[model samples]
Target: MRAQRGLILLLLLLAVFCSTAVSLKCYHCLDPVVSSCNMNSTCSPTQDTCLYAVSGMQVYQQCWKRSDCHTEVIMNLLEVAKVKFRCCQFNLCNKSEGSLGKTALLGTTVLVAILNLCFLSHL
Candidate 1:
């Protein structure tokens, strides 16, 4: 029974480590221009844009007037050097928040794993 518990704990720790490892953001992937605007500002393609060192990493976005007064914008995660463009759009405010939650969860899992590993080793 003790051995089984140890194995389960080890597996959990491994999972946590993997989650945290992948959660690290790639700085090169950051959108430089668009990142500067105030979160609540009325942004447009002209006002909100991102430039990246990687040739095609720029993202263009804008928030227009609507019934809900919400933001609407298109994102293009592109690699001009590789000739690739990943495009997406968001009108909902919770989009980025959800990703942030995932990152936090992964980080927490990793922290738990490390703590568990340390505790088990001591035992």
Candidate 2:
């Protein structure tokens, strides 16, 4: 009976560790300065990307871009965020943010792994 109790405790700890380990937040950024344009124009745009881990062993990533507006003439910039886990193959989840022409861009990606356990059926 003692050995069984110890085994149950170890399994519970392992489950908690795995659940927390897979949940994380990641961010990335990029900035490029532009020249030779109107002073009123916005320049040097920067892009930010974020990746979030969700329930059901799933992952989601998103990105957003904005102008720095220090000078003029908007420029292009690129940034990327990546997440990997042992439950999934290499580069299981990732996100990229970049500027296109004179506009900013955003993107998102998601990955999930289903767990098949009924330990918390009451909850």
Candidate 3:
């Protein structure tokens, strides 16, 4: 009965972890003189996406909403006639370069390892 309760508790914890909505993390910068922005920030709950935009020589990297990724909307926001931009949903994805996909993968691996240990201990 105790083992069953432990399993139930573990499952509940996993469920809560998966269901929790974590705020988006993004790189925040506007009109940076350098080619890269080193500043990082946590986005608000309503901001579900990371935005990277370029207008002429100016660069912008910040949090945004998934619904507002339109070209006209960005143009109006930046007050530029011509602009190029991309929106992503991952943390720090607004950088000028390099892949940061390992964070989630590493977390999942650690969680799986911990769960395996818990199960093995019961057996």
Best candidate according to lDDT: 3
* lDDT per residue as tens, model 2, 40-100: 2111123222222222223323222222211121122211233331111112122222222
Query: Once model 2 is optimally superposed onto the true structure by TM-score, how far is the C-alpha of residue 25 displaced, in angstroms?
Result: 3.4
TM-score attained by model 2: 0.23
Off by over 4 Å in 3: 1-21, 97-123
Q: What residue pairs are clashing in model 1? A: 34-49, 56-78
Clashing pairs in 3: none
Model 2 bad stretches (over 4 Å): 26-123
What tens-digit string does per-residue lDDT give for candidate 3 at 1-123? 769866886898777654443667899988658866788999888888899888888888999988989999999877889988888876677777444456556767987997887777576
| Tens-digit lDDT string for candidate 1 (33-110) | 554433333234332222212235443223322232222212222313332222222222212322546755675797
Candidate 3: deviation at residue 55, Å?
A: 0.5
The C-alpha TM-scores of every prediction are 0.27, 0.23, 0.64
For model 1, where is the 10-residue window of minimal lDDT?
86-95
- Residue 65: error of model 1 in Å? 34
Query: Which residue ranges in model 1 land beyond 4 Å of their true spot?
Result: 1-95
lDDT of 2: 0.27
